[model samples]
Target: MISSSRCTHLLLLLPLMFSFFVMGFVDLVGIASNYAKADYQLTDTTANFLPSLVFFGFLLFSVPTSILMNKIGRKRTLLLSLCVTMAALLLPVFNKSFAGMLAAFSLLGIGNTLMQTSVTPLLSTVVSDDELSSALTFGQFVKAIASFLAPLIAAWGVHYNVFGMNWRILFVAYMLIAVLAVMVLSATPFSDEKPADTSGLRSTFALMRRPMVCGCFIGILCHVGIDVGINATAPRIFQEYEGLSLTHAGRITSFYFICRTVGCLLGTFFLSRVSNRRFFVLSVVCIMCGLIGFAGFRSETALYLCVALIGLGNSNVFSITLTQALQSCPEYKNEVSGLMIMGLFGGTIFPLAMSMTSDGIGSQLGAVAVMLVAAAYLLFFAFKIQGKR
Candidate 1:
């Protein structure tokens, strides 16, 4: 009977976890930006704006989505996000104009922002406190599966001439999955805890005053900044050093995500037994090494090694940081989740800084330097977590 109940619990959790895969749809912006660059003949700085647009929604919608979850409930909020994402994916299918692509990506960002704000908190409700970090890490592993697939699927679309739609057909494939996620999650019943206190922008901002909260917020900022930075910059490194075409350079991007997927899969078990602080410190060191190697090394093999290190190091930072914050202040999970998701605005800030620097220096190494600074900040954040849960 106990095993039966556990199986039932696992069955229900499956669909919620699938939503993490849907959340990964936002990462399509990286490859999509490259496609846009080729098609529009835009400069690197201008092409970079596409990713900036996708993440900009995090700045505008994360906090509000948190507040909305309080009123409507997490599962319902997730469904809303899925619907928005479906709409976003459909737009580019019919029209490939720059304006149409921008509109589609904007909606993609908004939906992903809402999904990020609500989905993890919803997962937290399902699992016990002790399991939160591991569960979230596993969720990240699932998300990385989708991330790693984006470029491959786009490349496949171009190769097979599927639907005569080019890489935009990736959107069509994901739209169908989004519809399935909506249906499954809607039918699965989740008990949402009512808000005990009214939360708004003021209260959410007030969390920054707490040293721990502030540190975690900055930790998330650096983690996401690095994640987006690597996603946007890795391909360029291959292109510059090896003279690989965009299609082949994309394999390096997939390699980074593959390492991340494996790292998160391992982290799901290790985090449950190892102290979060110890593991986090180790991960930060790995990222710093990767950053230094990426900045200094010009050889193809060396650069690939560095990319793998960074991916492995970064895989669990978000899950670890977020779970620690929620555990410390269990009362304000919604607000904390909102603030953490807002830290994803680092996605916007880091890529823009990298773009500007890469343009000025006339080398991809300039962009790597920006990530080095982000990595240094993560090193500091790791120290602060030494004795923390």
Candidate 2:
């Protein structure tokens, strides 16, 4: 058994840091898309497409990777993910050509999506159950930190001409982070406890068939749509209509992450005290109100507040939903967890849908309005929550 003191080592944070690095790079793919557009003189539709392709990786890998994790075990699963991440990071070095770069982005997307799915479940294993909420929140808090610093990292890469040939210097950074994650996983000891019959494909499918699994799956799916849609749309609303600098708009975006970090902390503090149902239901209402506030008006200050509010709405959705999903089917937490992460594909589908809609209408705000409709739909699920025994 892995001892608590061993788990307390900073190495525990290595996964968080590496996960953050992967997440930061993935989220910041937008910067690469923008840079590629200018350098290559690509069309608007094509340029706008880069991030969505990366998002598609999230859709594709969430479930399959988790099943892989279940069969192969978490440590090896993570190693496999990191290897792909390394390869993806090197894409720009070899293929600065448009097709090459898009392929690279897609590779990066698949690699990172798998990394995220594995890391979250991996973290859940290392920490004590009482501290689960706190550990998860801290992981997210660190993730917010990564999301926080990504732009700055990208800006420095551009400022100094780090890549020199293509904007692939960022990939070097990603590679370094992956190496560190690998080192951390090697050094640290985590519970290798995995669900039963994991190697059998039939058992995995059987795990998914449970109603509890289905509910958590949908809950995670809807929540991802709610969260990703808000993040994607808020920046656009500020940049296009509110007339904020893209950099300034990012600050507002940071506020959403900040609110999410806060919500995670709050959830950690009260996880034992408050019922998940109450929290999930209330958060859904808050998210809708925040999105509606964004849609209803075009105020800058108001927009920032709403974005933060939306963050508040979603701050605990991941934790609450994951917990609920596990609670619903404790007999198969790993399978259920994998199933839950698959729901994260909503990140890909919802944002892409919003972006395509906005492009069709020639308005960024219209994209946000589409998300408002999504948030409203989520309220229905939030109403159905019942804390499992």
Candidate 3:
């Protein structure tokens, strides 16, 4: 029988994990970027601005959100993030103007930045140290469930014309879920970490003095860059090489997310028994092979196989890198969490780079070239983690 205290703890953990799903709402930027590109007849460079705008919020808001958490408490901060997310989703429903979407994507980034700043550290308080890595990976699995669904939902909205609205209906559906998440989380009570003095940007920067912290920070950048890069480019790859229509090509994005969702689900179990260093290196190698195979081959079957490989390989890198930073400076979890999430600006950096490279070379192969560089960095990071356990 479950003890009362254990039951209470489980209740607290549920809402915190549910917020991870909310955190994933930002991934919609990937498919939304393509939709906007089609609607506007945008160049690769211009359409990428949608995703770039979304991640740019991470650069501007992440550290401040951490400081805000220290002042307001993590739970209240999380609620604030949800409120911001709801507002962002509503903007598109009311007006689908280009400027309106830019604003919506920016707010979406800000809300997700705030949620990422608080959610993991908040989860750490409920679970034990030894359990932290696997627990976070499970949180990631929940997050991927949302990421996996975004493209499918967008595709459905496009096809069915739900509510006489098109892809914008995806925002409406997500906004409703956000409202539910907020209500459930606000009603639940959990003990908060006492506010910390190290919330300042100066102190957050100081933590970079630690070698592992810096390495993990860059590792995060590469992980998110590749994740977002693949998401934004997968459909285009199909369109460019196979001459498929956008609606049909969009399924490739869904396929990538499907593999990623499965990878995170498996990671939660394997991470319990396998050394993180060992598992991380193997994952990196899988992506490296995928990228190289992609650069060399254009066959439809090879494309599908390599994309699935990239998805499976990239899946656990974020959770693993994040848990490493948190464990490295357990006392500084809040500050470190902010700095690491700030690295998500890589989502902005890579997509823009991929865009220009594609434009410069006049092919999606330029984007593939950019991802290969990202995969190479992850491989090097993998070796850095060897024997650390």
User: Tens digits of per-residue lDDT for model 1 on 1-389?
Assistant: 56987987897789888899999888888888887899999888888888888889998999999999989999899999999999999999988899998899889999999999999888877888777777787889999999999999998888887989888889999999999999899888888877888798888889889988889988888898899888878898889888988888877778999999999988887876788889998898999999899777889999999999999999999988887777767888899888889888888888989999999989988888899899898888887774544
- The predictions' CA RMSDs to the true structure, in order, are 1.3, 3.4, 1.2
Q: Model 2: runs farther than 4 Å from truth?
A: 1-24, 34-48, 158-169, 199-203, 206-208, 244-248, 387-389
Local distance difference test values of all predictions, in order: 0.88, 0.69, 0.88
Per-prediction count of colliding residue pairs?
A: 0, 0, 0
Q: Write the per-residue lDDT of candidate 2 for residues 1-389, one digit (tens) a residue.
A: 86877758456667655665556556556556656766788744566577667767876676677678877788777777777877887877777788888888788778777777777677767666666666766666666665545555555666577747434576777678777877766776667777665534456567678776776677777777766565555665787776765545545555676677787777777666777777777788888877778667777878777777788778777777677676667666666666676677776666677777877889876666777776666677666667531
Look at candidate 3 and tell me the lDDT of residue 287.
87
The TM-scores, one per candidate, come to: 0.97, 0.85, 0.98
lDDT of 1: 0.88
For residues 264-374, what per-residue lDDT tens digits would candidate 3 score against the true structure? 988988887788889898899888888787778888899999899999999999988887887788888888889999999999999999999999999888988998888
Badly placed stretches (over 4 Å) of model 1 are: 386-389
How well does candidate 2 score on lDDT at residue 69?
83
**Which pairs of residues collide in candidate 1?**
none
